[model samples]
Target: MGTTRSGEAVGTAFGEYAVRPVRVGEWAAVKALRLAALRDPVADIAFLDTYEKAVAQPDTHWRERTARAAEGADGMRQFIAGTADGTLVGTVTVLVEEPGTTDLAGFPVERRQGHLVGVFVRPGHRGKGLTEVLFEAALEWAWEVGVERVRLIVHPDNARALGFYRKAGFVESGITLPLAGNPDGHELEMVIER
Candidate 1:
């Protein structure tokens, strides 16, 4: 566990890595980390967007996206685990969903909640507890924002992700969302109430 420090920073120690929110000027690093995540073997099931699409996005898009998630943003925040030298090794983004808004699946959001998305840890950083630290920062921010709960959608075939979510205290909400191109396949919704 970590203590809340100045700003939205969490003083969690993971060897030489520190977990903190992304900065506006670090857009390039953000884009780089995301692209690397999309190149992973399970990327097809772990991420909603493909590397081809993300790679095609212009620099401006990455800049604006990072700006939206930078510190002080109320709608969304992205937390990253970085080395002492500033190499980002993992990341997770939380998007605050208000009551009455439709989620990415077009389903109504019945309560104020945090939607966890784009969770990734570099392959080399895996098994070092980086992802757990990232999640702690993200969940802390979400609870601070007064969300009722935090939720994440996972592909049914993504066993590793499901196991992690369960270990992190998220339980299935009994909701299954249809996959875009595969009508027979669906994603499961898991949540951790605040």
Candidate 2:
């Protein structure tokens, strides 16, 4: 329902999808949508975080997360794209990780950076270029927050994810981290420097 970056009247990109922040107190919706993503076929390779753990989190957890991503301090943002019908089609979160501080990847983050995570587009919405729009919004927000670069990691075998990220101007950094939840799960780190 909001205007685009140019302040033009917004219309459906492919007859759906409007990128916006998840509403406050929409924690229930957030929880359910994420559970659905966790059950997706590639979740094993897509996320180091799990649905089982997510669903088990208390209402307060969802509350805190939504609040932080939606309206919290300036370090993070969660953008969800949805249909005109209000069905969430895709989601991603941007975390501004500062230099001299360790990041989620357990690496010594040397410069200010933004990290993208929890990216998912529902089965019905894949291939509509929705993810690219979502990434653009995130990358813009990261730069606004003064990060020098933005980074993401995907499973080594996930060509689809790699393709999307590459098209979005991310390049492999030749760095990898073992998945925290699985012994064999390894992630390919990619980044776009501002």
Candidate 3:
């Protein structure tokens, strides 16, 4: 029965972890979690950034990124599942998409919505329902901000993520985006609406 910065009830704890939004000035934790996620085996499809590139980023980059998603930032929100020992084992970020702006691919946003990204959980933290709790926190934030729909893109080959997204109430939107570097590769778009 813990709450986020916005005071939203983030729901029950799972084992040793509790889900909540990352706080301001916690860039180091954010950076560490992201670096860990990039090192995962499915990093190629699960994220657009590479471990090499992420590690090379200066501290300022991480600081600013963290500030943008920190509590009270209107444009982005990042949720993490922190263990009782203070280790963050999982995270998810949501970006607000305005109707007048373009998506990462330059596609026009048709309406104001929330776009989920940077989803991850440490290898040892997989299963046991941590991911679901993280999603619940992230989605709860989206709905609180008045977004009627939320979307995410997953590489078609990422079966694990696809299954998880579906189980979280996101269904295929039938939209596929071509990978930036690999022309033949594509990611499927999924959405969850109230």
Clashing pairs in 3: none
Task: Give the per-residue lDDT of model 3 (tens digit) for 34-74.
Answer: 99999999999899899999999999999988877875476
> Count of backbone clashes for each model?
0, 0, 0
lDDT of 3 at 40: 92
TM-score of each: 0.93, 0.88, 0.93
In model 1, how large is the Cα lDDT of residue 56? 100
Put down candidate 2 lDDT per residue, 80-183, tens digits, no spaces. 88877777778889988887888886789888889999999988888888888888778877887788889998987888899889999999999888888678
Q: Evaluated with lDDT, which candidate comes out highest?
A: 1
TM-score of decoy 1? 0.93
lDDT of 1 by residue, 1-194 (tens): 24545544454667989888887888999999999999999999888899999999999999999988976476999988888888888999999999989998889989999999999999888987788888988999899989999999999889889999999999999999999898999999999997
| Candidate 2: stretches off by over 4 Å | 1-14, 72-74, 181-185
Rank candidates by TM-score, best first. Answer: 1, 3, 2
- Pairs that collide in candidate 2 are none
